[model samples]
Target: MGMEDRCLPGGKHKASPSPEGHLGTCHLYRENSCCSPDVIQDLTKANDIYWNRCGNLSSRCEDYLQQVECFYRCSPIAAQWPHPKRPTAVLAVPFCQNFCDEWYDACKEDLTCARNWLTDWHWGPEGNNCNRECISYGQMYKDGKELCETIWDDSFAVSTDPCECLTLSASDTGFSASRSRHEDSDSIEEPETPKKDSRRSGRKGLCPGSPLLHRLKKNLRKRSVFMEDVEGSGSGF
Candidate 1:
């Protein structure tokens, strides 16, 4: 949307002091009784009577005027943005993602550059070097095994040591040599493989093949057990 189309009076510079005797085409003039001012003289009178004494606007009328002022102020931001406007029918609607695609497309390039910077600063997914959860993370179980296909592969193995790979805090337990020793030994002894067990009926041996599924399953089981205890306690009450 153009800046002119977004602002009140449809252009810059506010409406030209309302033509001679007319109240100019502001939406407020038609709906608000107090907005009957057409000239500087009338504005002075309004300022003396309704403004200083009776309040600038009645509670009923203030909302409409405030909304207009807010929209006028915010329209510049909306115009500066390249995202497509929501359709007029849905403009007043809330909590809708209808314009997300347009907004995402407009901001995608900047977001990608930011993510890259985070990667360099050791805050990105690539910087974590977490082969399990990082690489094997999937949107859902139904997203398929392909989501975890890149995990635990030779390509994911970095030539540099963990601490050298990223500037992590020496105090962080996970970044310590002892943590590395524990992880390496555990991975070697357990082989970090899937349990090959079934959780759903008629889905025999159809669990996630990714080792990250172990942590995911453990978390889910813990949550389930926690909820069960809560329910049991509530029942006793």
Candidate 2:
């Protein structure tokens, strides 16, 4: 997506004022009423454990985890906003994009592990299914904000039901299985060679020929957003 397309309407400088008419900030409008702090805490711990266990496979994975934590920590609106508006959405972009560049750098040398981490975290048994259940909450938080800002600018007049927002279509999820498949086709230029090597090297470690490495390669690719990080740009939402 283009920079203009990714940003909240009216750009970063212009913010919608509060009902009382003060310049509204996310902290001022932060909504966590619907969130169970205990639930978020539990999920946070679960996320940490999952990443720690998987991090053993690649130290670079720690960088990606930082981005995940950033999203989880800053997305109270995603958890609590029953009806989200533009002001709140605009407040969330910078926080979410804060770690994008770092995440991209961490994944550059080990893209396979990065994709596997995302896939397994969301769909693997060890992920506690929180990837599918909780991460979407963060995405909803982002999408809701973007939707409101794009359509309404600084107006709080538009309100979106959080439940409806959460029920995103595959495309709306921002990353689709087909996209993963496309990456698999385009990125894995020599999968056959890797498979052959994996069959011969029964040894462990993240070596290209290892079984674990093979599985990482077999899993789906993650969003191209991380790839943007390679340029060290913080432009993505």
Candidate 3:
């Protein structure tokens, strides 16, 4: 989208520099600021802080630059957005002593705001400032809002999925069909194996009854045989 079209309302954008205690967006001037000293100073200082903190990191500078840009972009919205919320803490300094941890935290905050704007200002059906097709829109968010043909066919429906959680749209019958096909494929690929009982795998025990009862039965049988033998021999006493 064009830069001018992407401009946020003045009330919604404002950033407060922490250490320097400065308050402003990257657009330090009301007019074009290509050669403005204030604009240049802010950019230089912000870059210095970021580079010092991230110099040792092995990644490209693209992500960092985008994050730094957020202060310029979103700070304006944070400042004058219709909502009466307090000014957002936009870090002017790039590098932190905390290093990686702090960078990750800062990036998340900026990106989150960017993502919201991507939907509300650009991708949402009602969006006038931005369009869903912008590369930056995809970079800032997962999936763009779903643009679906309404059942009536006279109008279209659109909704932004925060966090880009799901790719499927409610209007998509194809998604359901694809899901069913996948499930069928999975079933055909592998059938359930029958389970065996482990308890019956071993040999049977000698005593069907309790150990004590079996021992008693054997002793009684032996004693009766001995008595019968004694009675037959005339030693019944």
Candidate 4:
């Protein structure tokens, strides 16, 4: 198949905007507008040369340089295309991270190129932003897991798997945990103090079920009172 034909499976073309108004389709344009005829020919010739040279290598060691060179030659092709939309990145990064992790785990023992490729993508300055975003997302997920564990322990009479609690509505819980602290910070306001003694006492069990909830509430209330007292005393000076 020609380079344009091989660019997509079954010669399928991705749609692009054009001056004529209706959707336009071209394999080379879909790959990248920068993929001029000369560039396409050069890349194809390079691919052929590399494969002919390395296709029959007896060992991976002999193929390593050729593989690296081929990747180096091809990597620039990605830059020729426009960056993916932010929404697309947001949707795709998690799946990509999981795929990388799974592939690395299964192949790292024997595939030097695969290991190097992952490491380079994660650590190289040009490519690390996506990986960094994935890392931040992973940390938020860990935080959400911890939050679920805390809630599970506080609400249940007997021990249960925190992960099982997570499975009830994992995505919603994870998203809430990720955004909760920022939302709380932005929405902070002074708490209203209760006037009645019984109402004040009832506040000791902020959460339902666990006996420890009262103690947790009491400690938090004590800290709030101390801060209030300090603010009042400072205002007198």
The lDDT for every candidate, in the order shown, is: 0.24, 0.29, 0.27, 0.25
Where in model 2 is the C-alpha error above 4 Å?
A: 1-36, 42-49, 57-67, 77-99, 106-237
Highest lDDT model number: 2
* Poorest 10 consecutive residues by lDDT, candidate 2: 166-175
The candidate maximizing TM-score is 2
> What are the TM-scores, per candidate, against the unseen true structure?
0.16, 0.24, 0.20, 0.17
Off by over 4 Å in 3: 1-37, 41-44, 47-50, 54-59, 73-75, 80-237
Runs of candidate 1 exceeding 4 Å displacement: 1-207, 235-237
Model 2 TM-score relative to the real fold: 0.24
- Candidate achieving higher TM-score, 1 or 3: 3
Provide the lDDT at 202 for model 4.
15
lDDT for each residue of candidate 3 in 38-131, tens digit (9 for 90 to 100): 3334432332232222122223333333333433433222221222331222212212222223333333323221223312343334323332
What lDDT would candidate 4 get against the real structure? 0.25
Q: How many Å off is the CA of 96 in candidate 4?
A: 3.1
- For the record, the alpha-carbon RMSD of candidate 2 to the native fold, in angstroms, is 20.8
Clashes of each: 0, 1, 19, 0
Query: Which pairs clash (backbone N, Cα, C closer than 3 Å) in model 1?
Result: none
Compared with the true structure, the alpha-carbon lDDT of candidate 2 equals 0.29
